[model samples]
Target: MNFFKIKTSWSNAEFILIKLCMASAYILVGSYFHDFFAEYYSILIGIFIITAIWFVYQWLKKMKTHSDLPY
Candidate 1:
């Protein structure tokens, strides 16, 4: 399944707000996981950081989107 093909009814700000909410929820759950399995903390943090960077990149790219239609 392609993720980019999925359409959302939310505007950019709403979408960013939802993303922040989801990121915080993941951090909360991830902290619990880290507490129980401390050995994997580095890997878990690495993945989280990478995913956060990817999200920011996608958001920036989306914001920079432009139309080439004649004015």
Candidate 2:
């Protein structure tokens, strides 16, 4: 399913909680599956790190969002 297909009715608090949960899940899953992608894991991790940093910057710097926080 696509990200847009997910239903998130909660406000900012819920949004933050969801993000934290997703990040934690990523870390846990990656650690457990490290052996499966020993070489490709670095690329995956770099992309994840870049995406996460971009997300953080957008969230922290954005004062007024025309759409929702997730968008």
Candidate 3:
């Protein structure tokens, strides 16, 4: 029932890579069905954009935390 729970921790880069892969899959599918489902295709593109933004945010946050650590 706890769908959001992740079984194992992932590094920021790994997590972002996973999200990007999902987004790419969505884009491919959307493009394939563009003629039949323009609205849904737009939705897929929106999701991809959101995912990309999230990846950037996470990557930046990770870098900030690393910079704050004592070397």
Candidate 4:
């Protein structure tokens, strides 16, 4: 029952890049359609921030675990 035991094959850079692309797409679409996105802009931004923070946290945790391993 380990919460942080999940593993990913993608490198940190790739994961971050994908998340950035998604966030950028949302912003771009919102900018293009102000009427539709104005109300949800804050929510979208919040999601992006949360996801970025999660990714960083996971990466840091992974790094810490790896650093502690005997080579």
Candidate 5:
């Protein structure tokens, strides 16, 4: 009976929307940069994007495991 007592707010939805918007903006910017840079150094922009993503993943992993805070 208690299973239906859950409460939720729009905070999570808002957060997701904001993240989506940010990701869309990032995609546009990345594409522009990729086009601009690929003309001069082919594949350099892609490599840069991959490296940045890798570092962000590593940082997130470290923070998740090294902190006492709850996820």
Candidate 6:
């Protein structure tokens, strides 16, 4: 049984903004509350970089597929 429904009309800008806000909030809160970053800094950085690259790749691919530029 499906417990929740998702809306897929979100734009790329909203996705990026939310991701940035959440990551910054997590880092800020974690630093203030404990040593979360001190222990997993590398892992977090790697994931952030990889995800950014993946997002750019997907965005570009989608744009190219839907381009309407005139020759």
lDDT of 1 by residue, 1-71 (tens): 99999986867877898899999999999877866878887987899999999999998787667443345
Clashing pairs in 4: none
Output the number of the TM-score-best candidate. Answer: 6
TM-score of each: 0.46, 0.41, 0.48, 0.51, 0.38, 0.52
TM-score of 3: 0.48
**What lDDT score goes with residue 39 in model 1?**
84
In the range 1-71, model 6's lDDT, one tens digit per residue, is: 56567546888887998899999998889879676458777888999999999999999998997796666
Return the TM-score for candidate 2, rounded to 2 decimals: 0.41
Tens digits of per-residue lDDT for model 2, 1-71: 69888986777876898899999999999899988989897798899999999999898677556455675
Write down the RMSD of candidate 5 (Cα, Å): 10.1
Each candidate's number of clashing pairs is: 0, 0, 0, 0, 0, 0
> Whole-model Cα lDDT per candidate?
0.85, 0.86, 0.90, 0.92, 0.84, 0.86
**Model 4 vs. true fold: TM:** 0.51
- What overall lDDT, based on C-alpha atoms, would model 6 receive against the true structure? 0.86
lDDT of 2 at 29: 97
Give per-residue CA lDDT, model 4, range 1-71, as digits (tens): 88799876887877898899999998898678999777887999999999999999999999999999999
lDDT of 6 at 30: 83
| Cα distance off (Å), candidate 3, residue 58 | 0.7
- Report the candidate with higher TM-score, 1 versus 2: 1
lDDT of 5 by residue, 5-70 (tens): 978777776799889999999999988897576576646767889999999999999988889676
Q: State candidate 6's TM-score.
A: 0.52
How far out, in Å, is residue 52 in model 6? 0.6
Give the clashing pairs for model 3: none
